[model samples]
Structures are given as C-alpha cells and as structure tokens.
Target: MAFQTTKQTISQPLLDTAASLYCSASPHPTLKSISDQLKSQGHLDITPLKVRRLLITAGVYKSELASQIQSLYDSGKTITEIMGIMHLSRTSVHSYLPYVINADDEETEEENLCQRPISLEQQKRCEQAMEQFQKDWKGESLWEVITAFAGCTFVTSKGLKFTYEVKQNRHGEPTNELVISRKEKTVTKATVIKAYEKLLELSAEDSEDGITADQAKESVPPRFPIPLSGPKKLGTFGASYLYPIFIKLGLITEYPMLSYFHLPFSDDIV
Candidate 1:
C-alpha cells in the first residue's frame, strides 16, 4: 500500500487576527468569542475548537501558572494547601502539575472494563443521597437533628468530623448541643453570630473598617473566631466546623446586602 499526505493551510490573515485578538488587553477571550470575532471581522467562519487549535499552534495559550504550581508541588506543598493558596480545585491543581498525564492518554481497555458506568438507578440513589446530605447537614433542621442525636459524630463533605455535646438545663432536659471540634474544644455559637454581625456592620458602611463593598463582594465567609479575644478565640477549629451549619440556620449571612450564602459544591473547605 502507498501512503500520501495532504497539507492543510491556514491563511496568514487568520493567524494574525487570532494573535492580535488573543493578546488584546480585553478580558481573556473564550474560543467561541474568538471565533465570533474572526467571523465578523475577518469574514472567515471557524469553530471554537479550531480557534483553540490555532491559538495553541501560535503559542498564544501559555501555561504561565502551571510552572509556578509545579514549583510549589516540588517544594513539598500538599494538594489541599496548593488548592487553598491558588483558589483552585484538586483536579485543576493536578492538571497544572507537570508530571500528570491527560486523562485520555491514561485510559486503557482494562481500566474501562473494571470501571462500570453508573446506572440510572445508581445515579438516582446518588442524587438522593447528595440531596439528603445537603438538607440534613445545615439549617434549623440540622440543629434539631443534632439536639436529637447528641453525642453522635458527623462528617462534612470536606471530611471534617465533629459532634455536638448536649447541654442540659436544671430539669436535666437537653437545652442546646454545644458543637465540639475534633480537638475537643467547645465552639461558642455566639462567636459565629458576632462574626456575621461584624460583617454586617462593615457591609453597611460605605467605607469603614477598611473593607469596601467591592472587597466584601469578593469575600468568602470568615473562617471563624472573628479575630476576637476570650471565648470567641477558643473555638477556631470548632467554629470552622459549625460555620456551614450557622449559614444554613440563617445565623450567619454572607453579607448585609445578601440574605444567605449559597455555598458552592466545589468549595472544599467547610
């Protein structure tokens, strides 16, 4: 058999447009946006994938941060620590690392045979479990459940384990369950409330406490303790464990302007 190769040519004008558009000061352009611009301005129709390929060929899409992430990994930083510092996911951190191979390249027939695709029934069960987990993990119902199941340990999605110690009144009836950390410290619920109050106070002012509305807008919920002294400072670990629970209970709002913090599933930290 004889083999023949055909060469595919891309016009210089198209290359120039892609380069100019990609390097522009405007926000990072998506492939779809780049394709749209090329079609409108260059009068050439192209797909987003093709635009991506052209950019890659031109060396316009550079992995500048990948090297830095790899350097951190080489310096003995854990994946969780790297994710925390870079505000990236575990998968993303792994992707940025130099030695990790692409998933497609790593896939094999044996692995495929061993791994079963999730059945519809299994998927439904998973969805229900996730839904129930979310529902039971936070809010007034969570507090109720904790009071009912005092002394039982529960784990969060992030694998943070905690339990509630039942606080009894004079009649020996359980009044409230004190959130207990893995370190055995009692977390004061009032501290979490106070942190939210501080956030509210800061958010209410136009420019007070050195926190601007824009800064508050970009802020994640405080990690707890609220930088205060005494009992508030005691539960840094415990308070963090209950922070999500407080948010669900409407005790800690994200900001004064916003009613509640809609926690993201991707948030690895509780």
Candidate 2:
C-alpha cells in the first residue's frame, strides 16, 4: 500500500496515470480535475478521454480490469457488487456497464457479492518474492522448500501432503517460494536441516550448551520439549523458546506456529 503514493508533490506522475485511466472505467469530477492539473503542469492541453484511451492501449496500466468486468458479468455479478470491491462509487463503475455486459450474461444467476480480483501490484510483489527466494536457495528440490514458507496446504501428485506460499507474475507465471521468514515461518525441508545442524552443534558443545537432547520422553520430533506447567494461550511460552530455535535453524515444518494448537487459526482469516 505504501507504494501507492500521496498526491501532493511533483512525483504526481502516478496520480496522473490513475486519473488518465479513468476513461476505461467512467469519468469523475475528482478524477477529471486531477488529470487536467497534471497535464497543465507539463504546459500541454490534453483531453481526459484521450489520456484514458492511452492507458487502455498501453503504458503500464492493469491488464485485468476489463477481464474482471467480463468475468463478473458472466457470473451475473451486478454493477453494484463490482463497484463495492473496487472501492469505486456506483456512478463511476456503471458508466462502462452498457459496453461490456451481455444480455445472456445478465440473465445468469448472480451472487450478491464478489471478491475483487487480486490487484496487479500484489501480483508483482509475489513474483519478486519468488525470484529472490530462488536466487538465495541452493537446494535441488525447490518446491518443497517454498511450499513450507507460506503456511499453506499442498497435496502432491501421489497424495503426499505439504504446504507453501504461492505467488504469480503479470504474465501469469507462478512462483512457489518457501517462507524462511523469522516472522512468517512457513518453511521446512533443507532450511530445517541447516537449522537442525546449528542447534545440534550448539547442544553437543562442551561449553555452555543451550539445548540438551534428552531421550524420548514423548513422541514429538524435536525430542527436547521444554516443560512449562500451566494452561497455554495463543503464542504461549511453549511456542516462544521452541519456535524461535526451530525457525532460526530453518527446520520448522509447520506453516503457521499456531497450527500446532487443537483449534487452527484459519477461522480468524476472512
């Protein structure tokens, strides 16, 4: 969201661009005036409609806007529903309705609400993250590594179960980058091996050893579960000492830290 800049400076190119794209949707006073001011600053007279068409033809505008409108119409999504998700007022979004909506599509059973398609900017960020992860990872099996990063569920071809963070680029290329993030912690596999090696070395040292791998007291994988005798809450002390170490070592197989709980936090997500 920070990438969407404030509207007061000479760096008003983006505002100009957004206003320019208004014709592809609908004309608006606020949008029109903003466009005029921006063009005037360059000492040129430009029509709002002309700027609007330029965006539709080319020059870094979102490709999916028209596609989303078409999809919504086919699914019987009303003009009101489209405007709500896009944060546009009813008047603005509906202006282009006659051009795109089809009689057959209009007759289809429509849902009262439709989630907005994910924005182009979000798609870009996802791609960048994937590229960076690939650049950093030296492992042979990359998918397994990235799947762990996102704290999401994944079922394999042969029915093997795993998880990951999935992303895509503008051209619809997908990237599955694991979450090795200390804050996000959805990663597993090799990162875990590296973390395990570090912790194991630390535990095995003759000096002030932080961890001691006691014999199987329970069937848990890590073997050394710290004992805190009390009822637990979300993000409990049990999670703190244990999770940080597992995360730092990159051995954490669980996507969300809270997934270990009896009731998953999925309910909390909309």
Candidate 3:
C-alpha cells in the first residue's frame, strides 16, 4: 500500500495572523513555535507544516527566513551555529549571505555621500546679491525676491549672457517657467539695483497709462501667485537655488503654513 499525504484546511485570517506573529516576534518564532502559539492563544489548530505552507504561499517565507539568517550571521554566529538555530543547511546560508553583505555596503555608500561645499567667494557674492535684493525688495513675500534675483542675469565664462523670466499662464498664474534668454545678464549688485531702478524708470515713463511704481511693485506679486485657498505656498524652481543663501541671511521665516517648494531646475547660476 502507498503512503498518502494529508491536506490541511486553514482559514485565510488564521494564516494571516500567523504570518503577522512571525514578522513581529523578535528572533522570529519558528513554524512549530507559531503553530503552538496559535493553538494556545488564538485557539486555532494549525500544524507546523501548514504554517510553513501558509508563509510560503504569502511570499514572505524566503525573505523573512533570509533576514533571520543574516541577523544571526551579523551577530557573529558561526555557520554551524546558525544551521542549528535556523535549521538551514550551509548552502542556504551561503546563498543569502552575499545579499545581506551587499545591502549593508549599499547603505554605507549612501551614508558616505555628502553635498558639495560652497566656496567662500560664492558665499560673499551671494551675500552681496542678497543685500541689494533686500534694499530693492518692495513685495510682501520672500518669493518676490527669489523671482527678481532669478531674473538677474550673469555672464558665463565664454561671455554668453543669460537671464530668467517668470512666465505667467492665461489665468495670470505663475507656472514653473523660468524662461532663459541670451539678453545681457546682470552679474553685479550694481547691475541688479540698476535693473529694478530701470523698471521704476520705465513705470514712471508709462505714468500716462496710470501705472505707478507702487502698482508696478504690486504687479511683481502677481508674477508669482500664491493661491488664497489650500495650504500656504512657497516659491518654485528659482526659489530653491536661493534658499540656502536666504537661510544664511535670515531672510526665511518659519511660519505654520509656509514651506519650501523644491522643483526641478538648473541650479547653475553664474
């Protein structure tokens, strides 16, 4: 007569509970231990073989088992000792060891990575720029300063001049559009001051159109809109590049609703 295997019937909830217990337990309990706990506490009659099948079916057995093996190995346990504790053979232990080691190495690499340090000269130039920005800043929000500074032009090493323009949508909303142009870039504090002064000069010239300097200043806010609804808004791409400098100069204030919005943009400012 041939020997027959018995099919176990367990509920989904019971299997899920067992898996949860297995994951949460420190030094994670074995299938046999889980079965015993379920029978004692949960009052569910589950065999160790059934628990194993359930864990495997849930797709957690291999990874969880490997984690347990790795934890034991990391604690300086010998392979033979791990074999006795986890009931895994040398081949199984060897197969998972590389993954564990590689994971740790990747974590170490990430931790070691540091941000590139800003130079003292750049810091001085940034501070000078901020000083000019503050003297000319007439708008209510720091976002206005960011937009103005973003519009300031700087010449590249090859003498290619570039500047940014805050593009607005049809609804008069400022999108994340910092349109770069090859116009004469304002590289110095004097030039930035002159740029704003020139705007006021132009606004004065357009007095016949009823556009006062104050109105022109008010117009700057509309160039970078913050919706009256929803959470309090911050500046966009142009804002991110200037944030570190703003922090250094104590220009940024902490408010309940205010946050720094980081959007994708080139941080390379001349």
Each candidate structure's TM-score, on Cα atoms with residue i matched to residue i, is 0.29, 0.19, 0.21
CA deviation > 4 Å runs, candidate 1: 1-64, 70-178, 181-183, 200-270
- Summed over model 2, clashes come to 13
lDDT tens per residue, model 2, 245-266? 2322233322222112332111
Better of 1 and 2 by TM-score: 1
Candidate maximizing lDDT: 1
After superposition of all CA atoms, the RMSD between model 1 and the true structure is 14.7
Model 1, TM vs. native: 0.29
Tens digit per residue, CA lDDT, model 1, 1-270: 001121344565676788788788555677677788888885565766566545654666545465556676675444544554455655555544422223432311111100134445544543454345344332333344334334444443355656656666789876544647566555444543444444434443534457764455344442221222122322444545554443322233222221123312221111
Off by over 4 Å in 2: 1-129, 132-141, 153-270
Best by TM-score: 1
Full ranking by TM-score? 1, 3, 2
Clashes of each: 0, 13, 2
What lDDT does candidate 1 reach at residue 186?
59
For all candidates in order, the CA lDDT equals 0.46, 0.35, 0.43
Query: How many residue-pair clashes does candidate 3 contain?
Result: 2
